[model samples]
Target: MRESPIDDFWVRARAAVPTLPAAVPEAWAFGATATDADALLSLVLDGTKTGTASSLHDCEADGDALPEPGQLSVILDGSDLPRAVIMTTAVEIVPFDQVSAEHAYSEGEGDRTLGAWRAIHESFWREYSQDPRGFSADMPIVCERF
Candidate 1:
């Protein structure tokens, strides 16, 4: 079996900014997918994207867990190299249909509008899922802002 990749990002990060919390990062992950991950990480590094939303159904489907406020997460690029670390500042669970415009703007996707985010995310979820029902208005979404 191939061993997982590892690096000294944590050590270097600590040296670069001494005031960061002492708590170790709780998770390491790339974005939702290769292309999306790279794009989103760019947004993050450029200080444009401050928040993200994900379908709770999708998380369950993928057997991944939700993130919580105060948890530090290492964001990685498409190549799986750690690039930046963000401490989740807030987390909320809301229905897909109920997502607010402010939250969508923080996502920094196409046009940075709620409608655009909805259209894009709806298409993404439908394509991402194997379930016959696909994306639904009432589906619970994890709205996380960091």
Candidate 2:
């Protein structure tokens, strides 16, 4: 089988950061579409974005483990190529409506306000959530800081 790009990226990353774990960590893009992924990745690379949020229902539906502090991740760009590595600095679960303004600012999206974050994330989850329940104001959100 052909070697995956993530594997190659992991090898180089480990070589550069010898303190990294021996095993490869999870790799994923930011948003549902390629454009979104690339845009979000740029924010991360520029130090503008430091946090992200996800749907708890979607995580459970997908059988993905919840992120924990100190867990490393490989962030992928639009083309599914690894671009940067990040470590989870914190994780909090809260209702969509209760997400903090500080968290929203850390997300580094439009206006970096809670209102914009809610609007953007609500629209995103409504259309792209993996959970059958889709979007709801009371839905649990996984707020993560990297």
Candidate 3:
């Protein structure tokens, strides 16, 4: 398999942070697209956004695996360069409607409210899928905290 952009970063990071394990990272991304990825990565670097969510079905559809706790991943910037390394501290699979206000707050996006998070995330998920049925309140979401 082809190495991801994150692989290059992992090599550099391990060199810089000698304490980091030598094992390869599981995955890495810039969070969303250009603008969104920059923003989210900033939040993570500044210790603002500690939580994120994704559509479980979307991952399955894309053949991308969901993250598991204890896995280490790199956070990338808009140019697909590494900005930070994050270790998954927790993972919760829940329906969209079951997402709590606390989780929304941790995302550090919009007004930091459940309504804002829901609106933003739902819109992203909907547009992310070509199918109209991509997003729904009952959709299973993977809520990850690091």
Which candidate achieves the best TM-score against the true structure?
Answer: 2
Descending-TM-score candidate ranking: 2, 3, 1
Model 1, 103-126: lDDT tens digits are 999999999999999998898888
- Clashing residue pairs in candidate 3 are none
| Deviating ranges (above 4 Å) for candidate 1 | 1-6, 19-31, 130-133
On lDDT, the candidate that comes out on top is: 2
lDDT of 3 at 6: 72
Give per-residue CA lDDT, model 3, range 47-103, as digits (tens).
999999988887777787788888888777887777789988999999999999999
Off by over 4 Å in 2: none
Model 2 earns a TM-score of: 0.96
lDDT of each: 0.82, 0.97, 0.84
Predicted candidate 2 versus true structure: per-residue lDDT over 43-110, tens digit per residue: 99999999999999999999999999999999999999999999999999999999999999999999
Candidate scoring better on lDDT of 1 and 2: 2
